[model samples]
Target chain A: MAIHPLRFFDVNCGIGPYYNPPPGHDPSVSALLRGMDELGIAESAVYHFQAQQYDYRVGNETLLRETAEHDRLHPALMVGPGHTGEAHSPDEVAALMRSGGARILKMFFGVQPFVPGPDPFLMAPLLDRVAERRPLLILDHADIHGVRFDWIVDILEGWPGVKVILVLPKLEYHERYFYALWERFDGFFLELAGDQTMGTLEAIVARFGPERVVYGSRYPYFTPLQTMLQVIYSEIDDEAKRKIAGGNVRSLMEDVIL
Target chain B: MNTDSGILRSALAGEPLDDVLVIDVHVHWGRWLTMNLPAAEDGIVRKMRRAGVSKACVNGILNPDVAEGNDQVASAAKRYPDEIIGFAALNPYQPRPMIDELRRCVEELGMRGLKVHQMVSAPAYSPFPIDPLDAAWTQVWEYLDARNMPVLWHGVVEEAVIARFSGIPFVMAHGLSSPATFRALARYPNFHIETASTQNTRWYMAEAVDVLGVDRVLWGTDAPLDDFAHRWGVILDSDLSEDEQRMALGGNAARLLAL
Candidate 1:
């Protein structure tokens, strides 16, 4: 590690063993922290793998327990529309946020069993509650074909107060939807791990200012190295690299009232 | 803005590449795409240079003249022998001519492998989808298998077809097109996976290394179509041991190509 001009604040990462057998890394707290230390990741917003794979409560508890000692590890609780009591009511959601000291809420519509759409009853009220706290809402765009950018537009328009981070938006949709969202909404920020195409990161930083593009690792599932290098070795200036790597995320964290 | 020309490249160059060769296993060539992105060979070469890609395996996608596509790749390979490793595109719809073209490209023109754009082909000609397992495609599969050539195909093909032609090292261009694909092809020793467009994560590469071992994973860009830096970043930034990193970045591709 040559001393670089930037420290990374990974916005999307995970802990615990994944339910999917033999296909994903099961990074323990120590393992995750060690990687962060090695990669120079200053802080990370992490969720438990069980939160997405099994029960949300179990995942949240594990996240709270695992990351409790590490000040750099901020918990991003996996949340869904309160359908099967996986997540109950808006008040209960607020309680979970407050009790756990979680400032980020992550949703997995495509991977987990949940629906995010025009319907108000299924999700709107909970999102409205999340907005009041001003916590960052991270959504997984794991499958580009399945993710509807239009639905994201609805969230941006309807829940104006809630800050949104779209995690892992694939290369296929980056030009069309990622750029569209970046250009249109002030509320949304894109996690940078997914834009592995050449020149995409430098181009985004040049066009939209480094503030809109925050460093994300999609960690445990992915490593911090690729995106970290993408910023460190990018054609963009060091000031922009500094901001994209960690400053922007730190500033965003400062803004959150919680 | 430190505009010291090639500062990043210089920094990376200082890192040890003593035993490693970073060969990108996937890239698309020519301006065949209708939506119009810069798909030129020079653009790809420049991008490869910027990303420090020692070599790239490219598939030449030609329209109505499918045979010319193979020639285009062969020509590119000739022009940039060290940088470009060419793979002929086989249009499954034109099954009969594909075998002959494959022979010409590999045997005569020095192409190292074959590329099948099954996902692109499946949708483009949706009215009649070309199945990889159909008996008509057996001769092509057997030819590649006999020669022990690698096939880089996008999306999943039937595991049985993969099993039958198990002698041919099939580099599933998308991390075996999910875990089930990995489970299916796990039995076949010759099968491998290219770490391109499979999300840029060290953990993902680690997972691939875990399931298939370091030797089976190849780093790829799917470039001109994808970001070369971003694709390479996936391998460069992973948490795998230095040796595993070396293997995924190029050692595996080197063995595949017998370079």
Candidate 2:
């Protein structure tokens, strides 16, 4: 019944206005910070909805400008595979992110049409650039994205240095694929946004240790309290809970070469 | 109440409520067809204890095997009588009369309610999409309607059919995502919704309360399939008042089930 001592540093969150936001949903940076304070989240790595709904370049710029005053809000720029020239070259985008004081690169391969499949020849150049820079890459996967486990394996194999944290993955059915990936890739991490099934969190922490699991709340779209409770009420030890809550993500951001 | 409320504080502190009654209405036992889960009785009860859920209305996942599945629910309820409440699963597509199975489950197996999933398509049970409003389910509906029993329905049921069976308290298992459906069903007193969904937003509970009022909304976790703590935390952190929260958590369900 005692209050948990763990601090939370959310690795996946979005800020700015949504195209068709939920009723009573406030997507502003101030609202996000208020929600974080209420949920006891110490810090957050955030991306702009503009990056997702409109141009990534404009969205990335808007993110930096909006979150410039808030030191607790770390910028996470949305980057594509650079096939349409909208993102320019991978190196340019990487450099832009680094110069903006952003260490997290968010990719919507599932939702973005310009972002191609995980074919080696098509994605290798971007993967290679990502591997070289070593910024924390957050890949948002949903059923509509049509992302397969084999395709993810191919991507991880191609770019081993990139610290990839999979967000919003349907873990109920595809946990076997996730376990296989965790067993194979050391750079693999999981953002606990869509992990709602019972005992899966404990199993992941038990097998891979708590260092590879990071806490995340897909804010503005979803509540952070659910995932926060998932970590706090887990059967794992407080030390492991501490790592998963905030320590793991903080360490990941600190280790980014860019 | 604000974010500094006692319930929110207790939840943020990782402590389950001892003052309020917490009952999870959507739960299952046995293995799922597609994936591995902690669906066994021991694991589920342990999770309930950890989440401070006093009772869970449990049904079986073996939909194809109707008798065996009801038996599993019965066995679990018998073993943990205080902690488990049995809900019978009847495959209307089965050759036997569903009303007979309903009687057997309630009279012999001591089940309090009926659980049906018309959406799932298993080869041995429901090979094709059968309309839940079909004549095959009439007998079962009539039986429950006459007895004033409750039904926990997983798939979509039409508002007309729900109105036809007005005596039966129908609890929509995962709640309605569409506001149109909520508005349409707001007039039906027998129609209730629960807060157990994987595809929910932070505003879902508040929006449901706005449309259906707090009394018509119940709390459920869909446990072992979904985490209890996650769903519980969502409601605790919701914008509902403490009285509204209590009604949604257990007051509504306890009234429906006569607990």
Candidate 3:
């Protein structure tokens, strides 16, 4: 499958390649490249669906290896400190980053974040490791699936260098939590597709400045067309649209590109 | 064993609740919140064992989320023989078809009654308002009264719900907006209150023994529910005696539904 050179980095797409094992959707470089072509996406950082509900390290490692096997795919190895028993110790995570298995780490907020024991600030070593290795860390933003804004601010204050990506925040969450984090953090970025109303993106751009937001549609359960429609039909300016539609993610990905 | 029979153990909260054959009356029997539905043996066994529940009325969510719960509840009851009873929920708007379906759950599947949730996911016009004794909602009351099965309706309105269900046996849910509804539902002989999901509406369940008589209340927990079922356990641990406790737990529900 030929690649779409226009898409910078795709986010929120399902790793349906693992479960549905398509005639063309096998977990190979060809399958990912094909996915990008079908969706007109440039490079997508997808999460293994199996890992979303289960283990993270092995699934993440295998995904990274599969991406390595493919010359075209740029993989974001997802991680959650709460789900995986081993990675709670940031030292173990630091080792993984040093070894290059850890790219951009994904954290789930509703289930894994806000669990009592682990302090959100304790991830300094882990985020620092990703930053030290120049890898960006993406955090889910919403009361439903990610960390609270207070935690996001804590992360930004603690690890300013690590590019913080907010993933798939719900509508209410975007309005209340996103604004607070934007006010506090200098480099916090919003991942779109979760916010699909006409002026939602433009409103955020107006408030937080354009550089702080990017576009990533949660696909499969949600479709590429639906996500694409939101960005295409949005009232945000073409420059801001282009930045979110592709450019912002591209800038963030440049830091983590292997 | 004498001590056990007379004094039931309870988690801290309310007075020692009723202690008849403690039935959940409301339980989710099928697996699968999204996409796929598992058999839910774990859910059934774990919930029953956790609260020391002897019987449960089950529901499913396959058909608009709660459709299959009826069958799952009944089958679970069959497996344990009187340990679980299924109560099928009927969408009131679809009242015509419900005649046959209600017959199946009660006559064929042996479900105890109908458990309809107005707040959770029931569609609009399902119940065709059994209006407050006016000539308008006569058809709705006729259809419900015809079935003669106890309708476990999850209702929430002040004097309105009680007025609408004047002659029917309705289980006011969540204490129906606290003590006010709890006090009102008591006026009707057929209406009862199930303290299942009411976590802490003090006006609703604190001194429920004094508010709603022991016989007017039932101990039902939304099973496989998080520890919220502890609300009933709190009732069990309440200061009430074993006999007074039995009526609230199962005796009252069993008699009301004729189980």
TM-score of chain A of each: 0.91, 0.92, 0.78
Q: Compared with the true structure, what per-residue lDDT tens digits does model 2 show for residues B18-81?
A: 6778888889888777776743567888887877778899988455788888998899899999
Model 2 alpha-carbon miss at residue B124, Å: 13
List the lowest-lDDT window of 10 residues for candidate 1 chain B.
B1-10
Q: Can you give the lDDT of residue A157 in candidate 2? A: 82
Measured with DockQ on alpha carbons, how good is candidate 1? Answer: 0.22
Model 2 has a DockQ score of 0.57
Q: In what order do the candidates fall by TM-score, top score first?
A: 2, 1, 3
Residue B211 in model 2: lDDT: 82
lDDT of 1 by residue, B1-259 (tens): 1112232233333222323477888887776444234435777776666556788898886444667777787788888888898887776556546688888888898888888766445666555766677665787898988888898877435577787887788888877336566766766888888877665354466566667888898887677656665555566555566666667778889998888
For each candidate, the alpha-carbon lDDT, in order, equals: 0.72, 0.78, 0.55
How high is the lDDT of residue B178 in model 3? 55
lDDT of 3 by residue, B18-109 (tens): 34377666565554334121114444554355445566666653345344656666666787775666677655444345556666776788
- Cα deviation at A5, candidate 3, in Å, is 9.9
- Model 2: clashing residue pairs? none
Per-candidate clashes come to 10, 0, 22
Docking class of 3: incorrect
- Among the numbered candidates, top lDDT falls to 2
- Model 3 deviation from the true structure expressed as Cα RMSD, one decimal place: 21.1
